[model samples]
Target chain A: MVVQNSKSNILIVEDEKGLRLGTQRLLEEEGYAVSAAENGNEGIKLGTSKEFDIAVIDLRMPDIDGLEVLKEIKNVYPNTVCFIATAFASYETAIQATRIGAYGYIPKPFTPEEFIYQIEQGIKQRELILSAERLKKEREENLFELASEKSRLNAIIKSINEGVLVLNKNGELAYYNYAALKYLNIREINIGENVIDKLPSKIVAVVKTIFSNDTFLLKTYTVQIEIKPNNELILEAACTPVPHPDGSLAGVVVTLGNITEFKKIEVIKSQFVSMVAHEMKTPLAAVQGFLNIIVDDTINVEKEKRKDYLKRSIVRLKSLTDLVNDLLDISRMELRTKHREIENIKVKDILSNVLQMLELEIKKKNITVQKNIEEKLPAIQADQNDITRIISNLLSNAIKYNKENGSIGIKLGSSPNYLILQISDTGIGMKPEERSKLFSEFYRIKNDRTRGISGTGLGLSIVKRIVESYHGKIEVDSQFEVGTTFTINLPINLN
Target chain B: MALIAIIDDDIDILDASSLVLKSKGHDIVTATNTTDGYKIVKERKPNLIILDVMMEEPDDGFYLAQKFRKDGIKIPILMYTSVSKAIGMEFDKSEIVPVDDFVEKPISPEELVEKVENLLHLKEVK
Candidate 1:
């Protein structure tokens, strides 16, 4: 649009020299910047060369028709308003001028006031055309920006991990990502199509629940569902209402997240609880038997035998307490493992500490443990308690399962990459099948040999976790009724 | 009829069971381990025997019960089933664990006495 407060440029063309000069003088006196041409050819040249807001062309020119000049001016600057000024104003000429993009024509030999009024109307028309063109361009720019933003959002939704589905108020799928299709296992889907029937029944139920509820616009509903009957894939859906500004529901947005791993962990957690219960029940039952006999009125016990029963009951109860503490230790070891103090530790110290702890058992079983160490043994970087647990559990097993006068051999050696600790016992050994299940949680050997041996059954499971956490290796070698050996290889450096 | 034997690895179970039977005016012979339990039962020929389900070996009582039947000693055997027995089976799955009667451990003193008297009375009728 032409800038306001600046003089509007005007152009006048005529075959008559006096008329062209007179019109120019009149427009100049009216505070307009004017340019005049004597013929149609000159007008075309001046019109194409400079910008003008309004043009007045005279018809019946000698060189060319005034309509030709107007056509050329309109082709160059479509926003410029053109007018036909003719001495003989006729019905045919006025219609032809209007078709050639002229605002209105002026008659020759008119008063200055009449001519000035026509000029004023042409200026207004020129401003309207320019303003329309500016508005159209601005609208096009805004539409382009909106298109780009929509594509950018589509790209993000398609790549995000969580599945997204947007449904219209009519329950037709308006927008969705590939993740949504994959999560739902929907093979064929199209825009603006109803896929509710294709959804799993649980999710469909959620949708129906949302659409049927009166307060749907005010709440978000969550549903946990398996993808299909007895299927491993689990999904969690959050159906949130997309509302209009007037507090009315426009559509429902469903976001789905895969929670199969989360469900598996829950199953493992329950299995762990039952295992604890099973292990605890046996000891508790045994302790109850002892206590029952001691308190019975009909059972008259001798004084010395009563003392023995009381002492044995207390011992069994103490072991039960120890089992509970051990369970807590195992749970704590599995969880809250973020903070741990790692430092250089001596295997020798750990072994000696374990030996001292199980000294009574070793002495009672008459087990002779021989320690063979390489000179100048290197220190292993590990948590001290973890190493102590491994040693004590294995050492106690060696003592508990050993036959009278059986020998236990300990060998500590170092290779280039590993610190090897091996403990061998001439004790009752496991069959290959029993050895295989040794590290399983709550799995104790159920045969005759292991019946006499009391244990919490979680020692080796904890040992395996610690070994795997440190990227170390543990191996068991056994021949039933012959002997068993346990080997551990701890890496010197951690990455 | 007064001679009764109880076999269990848990010394407290053996002592407690023997005390409960002895108070009922029965002579009690007890073995804390499986081998001695078998020896006492075979030698003494007790009228009825209470056997713990597990001793030095799991299923020691079951094996002893089978052995007693194989030896052609038909005196009633009271199986002292542990908690493990309740969840696994009540001597139902295996024909090998043949016994005349069953009593679960942490045994009610009254139940043990009642079971012993019933077995003796059943043996007299047989």
Candidate 2:
């Protein structure tokens, strides 16, 4: 289906006025869009202004000859069909004109039919060259579209996180991406090469299943496999058959997803569940044991001993209640930063309130307090209970861990960007190992020095979480024999 | 009355266990930690040892039990564990933990006595 563009534009160059005018009239009656020039210079100017489909030149001219005009006009529009007409048609000149891309020659003093015939042939030739150019341009555009589509497909495949691989029906490498190479532990691969051998056997097994001879069976297969056993690098490979519309085997597509982090999370969750079980059970067992001994019918238990067991059970149950409360506090902190009643509050006031609440305990231990709080301290945005909880937990620890007549020190001040509070106590601190695990949930120091000290082991964990939720930080520095100090830095003027 | 050594970190557990065994006409010797418990058992040569896997100390019970075996102390150790047996972390008789048996708490007074008597009888038979 070619466009037959019938209207053809023609240009003629001749110095003879009668012949130029006569030829123009003959071509104009033939329905050609004709333009005439007197000499080569005039022809060059007309050629620059208009693009003619066919160009006719007189071989022998006055000043600027036809050869120069043909060369100039052809340079402007390379597909211009150029021809020569002359009375003197020599062999060398003909060869030279043909060398410069002249289509053919027309002898001068020719008949009218001959002139019209040559013009018709040149129009036909011009149409042929234009159609040929249109076909070449269409083919090049189609090729460009194909190349871009392929590269775009390639870019999509490479950027995805899932490892992708495609194999042809013969189990040779059709396509693969960078993630596929890394996931399958492949060093080098080439297209059309057999990739079945390079893959790990677990994945290879799935690929074989897809490529199996059972033509009726079309089902996706998935397998969870450990790629590196020692380090526990694991993956899940999913393979599906790529089928043709004719119910024939085309290829297989395989996708791999990394699941090592999920596996580790499951293990940690189970461990935490067991720890919670153990913590809940230990105190309950003591309380149950206390009751069991008191209630055993076969034993002759005295009233005083029964009373002692009952009292001890109450104490153990109290600690159990504290454990439950602490657990609830931790879960609440984890569940949401929402539902908190936030306000601007002074740390100085909260610290004093906590101290007043703990007055009885502090006085019973004979612990003296030394306070160094800066006046006009900047207010911090936080939940009031959160601040109270932090101060109370740390202060109580100082009181509980301190000896008789021990001193508790408090220093609350503000730096340029942060409100810094440091609380220290003259008490038995911890070893390096103990301090490292101090903030871990359900961790407590257990040795001869800590034999009498009792705790739920969740205090410091809750405190650290509360401080961090407000974009603040808490640090602990403790020496085994000297003392323990806790420092907190809460950001000021932070929304 | 046979002298029995009980090692536990919880003073209440030690007290309850002492009361339970004392009702059985046994002289109870108690230590609140592994070190003192080991010294008391070695010096007093108690006929039976009750070892508690305390929550505060991680893996201290297994270490103490194995240490006793390595030191050639053949006293029958009745371990008290708060970890549930159904949780599938049962402490069985092995070279890693050479204890006589496990007693998942809270052991009823009758069951506690039963396990302690069985282990002591096994010691005597050996």
Candidate 3:
């Protein structure tokens, strides 16, 4: 700490002129920076202004006592090493010097060798003290820097969306961010605590594997962890080793990216694709079978049978065409939304049109239809085509799903702000779970009653989409084997 | 001639399959959905069953098969699935889906006949 080989400054305070000059000359000859003070006051003044690594003070002085001078020097520069020079070698005075922070004393009538040796000892002691002081200051500075850096890192991690955790060389949790805590559903994590003891086994397993294997280090790995019994949390974690100053592995820093949303979307996409394929395949299979039979001449099929098969093929083809058309309508619904052609349209007209379209099916099923429309019903502001589609889809579903001789009820009323249409059917209804997914694309209720009903499953989705676009709401009430009632509330006009 | 039951949601599929199976000199009974399909199987005691996977929903075929097993019905089941192969839904006779075999659809007339014959023969062995 003395900064090896740098000249150490020495202050000699003596009331006697001859001894002070001689001491200064001897120290100067030994390549030390020596300053001479005639009395205790001068020594205190010089010690306060310039830092002297060592101070040699006469025990008895005229102006100020040597003890007082030593005390003042130590107050200003506590690192300065002091020596007491006194001809009077009293036991009490020596004790006083030591109490005043004097390193040691040089006795009177000493040999030149003894005097030089004492001076050398004082300089060496000064170096040791200064070195220790430098080390202490450096240590304080390093600690302050480490604390500031840690807080800065914590601030950065807190602002990011991704969760992060760091483990030290001993596999203890060194740092963790807010997102990490929230992801793990923990309130607080203590530093230097082993994650295996604190975190769930799933995460502990992943972290343990990462630490035990060298190949996993510096590589980004992904794993799906079930943070709870049934809920799965997908995390993509990247681990990198923290290197020490000597280029050794100090710890591993792990960053976790939440990919649960992405996984959910992937599942939804696959299920939708499978549903669409299943929907399309039914009609395709029917058509293929009928066409295959009709084209097969080896089997002695009758003319009437051939005609019937062809007719059924045509029906399957027609449904296929309808499916394609519905698909197109759905695409149009996505793109041409919010571009409704506003016009004054009577709800009755759309209802009549839908009834006319379903006349053949309704009559075939012997279904009785009832209607209750408010007198002088005000025209709702909506696109005629959309209202027609909504009414037609609902009526079609009712007709399709109805029991023979089932009753269909239609009620229309108007409030100040809304045109309400309610349709209830005494038919085969749906399970409660199926009602929630009734509006999802390509979703169809699957049970014994619904098994025979043929539909593209896009009807209600289209109805929901179209109604919502018009700032309207559709509510359904149903019980299995009882009935289903759908209530539509459409805002009359845009304000 | 053996009695075979065909279960599907599409009337066209039921008609077409009945025509083909009956043409093979096999007596055929058909239902358009699982409820009537189950009733037909119970009453008719068909030697074999041709089931569609997506009639009531995606797992209708599997559900019906499990129901048959639960009721101690040991008829050979030939499932018709459009997405079973496309989505790589493996058919495990030993596990989740207990069926004799699977036939991806568009109803290849020849493949249907072949699988039916093989399944009926396999059932006869048991």
Best by DockQ: 2
Candidate 1 residues A342-459, lDDT tens each? Answer: 9999888788888888888888878888999898888988889888888888887787788999999999999987889999999889999889999988787765576567777877
Q: Which stretches of candidate 3 lie over 4 Å from their true place?
A: A1-153, A156-161, A168-174, A181-221, A240-251, A295-300, A324-372, A375-384, A402-409, A425-453, A477-484, B33-47, B53-75, B84-90, B95-99, B120-126
A1-495: candidate 2 lDDT, tens digit per residue: 122445678898989999999999988888877899999899989976878878889987788888898889888887888889999989888888888888888888889899888877887788788889988999999999999999998999998988999898888988888998898788899989998888888888978877776683567788988898854888888888888899898998888889899989887878877777887777788898888887888666789988988887888888889988988888888888446787899999999999999999899999999999998999988878988999999999999988889999999999998999999999998889889999998887777777777788899999999889889999999999789999999988666
Q: Write the per-residue lDDT of candidate 3 for residues A136-181, one digit (tens) a residue.
A: 9999999999999988977988889888888886778888888888
lDDT of all the models against the reference? 0.82, 0.86, 0.82
Task: Compute the lDDT of residue A336 as modeled in candidate 2.
Answer: 80
**TM-score-better candidate, 1 vs 2:** 2
Each prediction's number of clashing residue pairs: 0, 0, 1
As for TM-score, the candidate ahead, 2 or 3, is 2
- Report the lDDT of model 3 for residue B49: 89
Task: Go through the candidates in order and give each one's DockQ.
Answer: 0.35, 0.60, 0.56
- The candidate, 2 or 3, that scores higher on lDDT is 2
TM-score, chain B, model 1, is: 0.90
User: What's model 1's overall lDDT?
Assistant: 0.82
- Per-candidate iRMS values, in order, are 3.3, 1.8, 1.7
